[model samples]
Target: MTVLALEPQPLAFRVRPQADECFDSWIDRVAAAHETTRPALFRHLGLEAAIASLDLARGTCGLSNEQYFAVYQVIGQLAWAVEIEVQQIEGTFLNVEASVVLPRRQRRYVCPLCWQQALRDGRAPIIRKEWILRMSWRCQVHALPLCALPVADGAMSEQAVGSWLSGAVARAESLRWKLGAHPRLVEWNAEGVDTLVRASRKRFKGEKKAYVDRFQANLFHFAHDRIAMLALAHSRVGKATWGFERLVALELPGRPGREVMTLQPPKLPPRRWRISKGSLRPGSHDAGVLDLVLAYAHLRVRRDA
Candidate 1:
């Protein structure tokens, strides 16, 4: 059938089975879907592992009690360590290693002046047109950023430096994952609790901006949305709580945020639900719900085609 003709059909057949789905399975699926996106730090599985690991560590570390966000901060440190190592390796080898191996791949270096100039001008020089660094870090030349960096001292070709740096970053990330210093609350004592609380509180506060900076950062990683959902699921309209609305307000980007929608209660007449699908981009099911809600509530606006 033609694509346009199938627009209104229910997608019951395409819904993947959620039965017995483990956390690892979900992680794998998420990683596979977003591996190609920009901002390497955000897409890296190490970040997730760091959070999950830290959470697991909190209870064992002998802290006063388990604070989910506290553990999340520890994971961020691991991610930062990986990033720093990668940048350091890239800068260090750009001048000496004309060619290098990064993990399973081989790379060559490029010119130093070219890269430096590009960096200075904030524009990435087009050496064969492939980006050499993260787009965000590229140099701006002619009002646009350049995507490649020249090797330091011209000792190695650009490609080689890039590969070497990539390899270094990968190795560091792997090592960080294996280090595992997370301890649980049960493992700590009164003194340990004081120390752990101070340390963890600082860590949590430090990451406040990062937590609220992006939708996915807050939703998937922060776990605030899920907690909020549970609260809203059980709350009634007049029984509003302090954090109840805030939870509902923090919707994932590109989906409705803070907007009221029909929330179907499990055992009663469907109540309005204000939910943002957050990174779970809408498909056929979403469209149907929108249609049903807007039609029933008289909120659907017709437009001229």
Candidate 2:
């Protein structure tokens, strides 16, 4: 007697991706609906190998050509298994060019208020794609500073995410002011951060490179002036306030066209200013630092005019 083989069936509980949701966020929700971990879900769907090959830790942004091909192939399989349109799955991935202007986040950050809203709405909280961008310091909707939580190194299970959200929300409630951006930082964000980000998104290679170079030059000058001001202000206070001393030493100074290194406390010895052989290069600086510099530069230019 011969036996017939049956094809794998689609998932019974297909959770759709939420708006502006990252790929991992969508997968976590799907895994929770099925009451399984992400790895187990992928394995059961026969996509363990394909999923493993993709470097999804930092997310779908800045994928190489080969990685893009892998994504297309894997998403096809993923969509079929989930019984969703391939476009729906593909929409979760960000196809932005990797640039220093918008660097990938080292760890996840979320808005506590947003998470609470999602819970109240009877849905799993999602990690927004915007929050993963290192430059995104505040929630556009709530106007609250995004809270940084120490997440597990890689993709997390739904239960783990829930635990993290709970802790983050509690922490946010307790230390709301502490987590907020400095008043100056807030002013900078309001002035020029968004404009700089929009300009950085130019598509053509030549145009993008030119714009980035100009941006970096402005950033270097801004950092130079801002660090000096921070150092002077902290020294007069006889101590650092709001981590300004650290901000004086923050990586921004070293990145500017002229390399400026500040001593700890920024008051002990004179700052050692040196000129680097080269100016700012693309994809070589932190997004947070760039955002700070951009804000100062924009405000400074406006004031000068």
**Top lDDT hit:** 2
lDDT of residue 29 for candidate 1 = 32
- TM-score for each model: 0.15, 0.54
**lDDT of candidate model 1 versus the reference:** 0.28
| 28-117 per-residue lDDT for model 2 (tens digits) | 778778887877777777665556545463445567787766666767777887778987776665554343222223335678789878
Q: How well is each residue in 155-241 modelled by candidate 1, as lDDT tens digits?
A: 455568556545533432322232211122112212222232233333222333332222111121122222222122222321222
Model 1 regions lying over 4 Å from their true place: 1-72, 75-142, 148-305
Among these predicted structures, which one has the highest TM-score? 2
Instruction: State the C-alpha lDDT per candidate.
Output: 0.28, 0.52
Cα RMSDs, all models: 24.2, 11.9
TM-score of 2: 0.54
Give Cα distance to truth, residue 246, candidate 2, Å: 10
What's the distance in Å from true for residue 288, model 2? 22
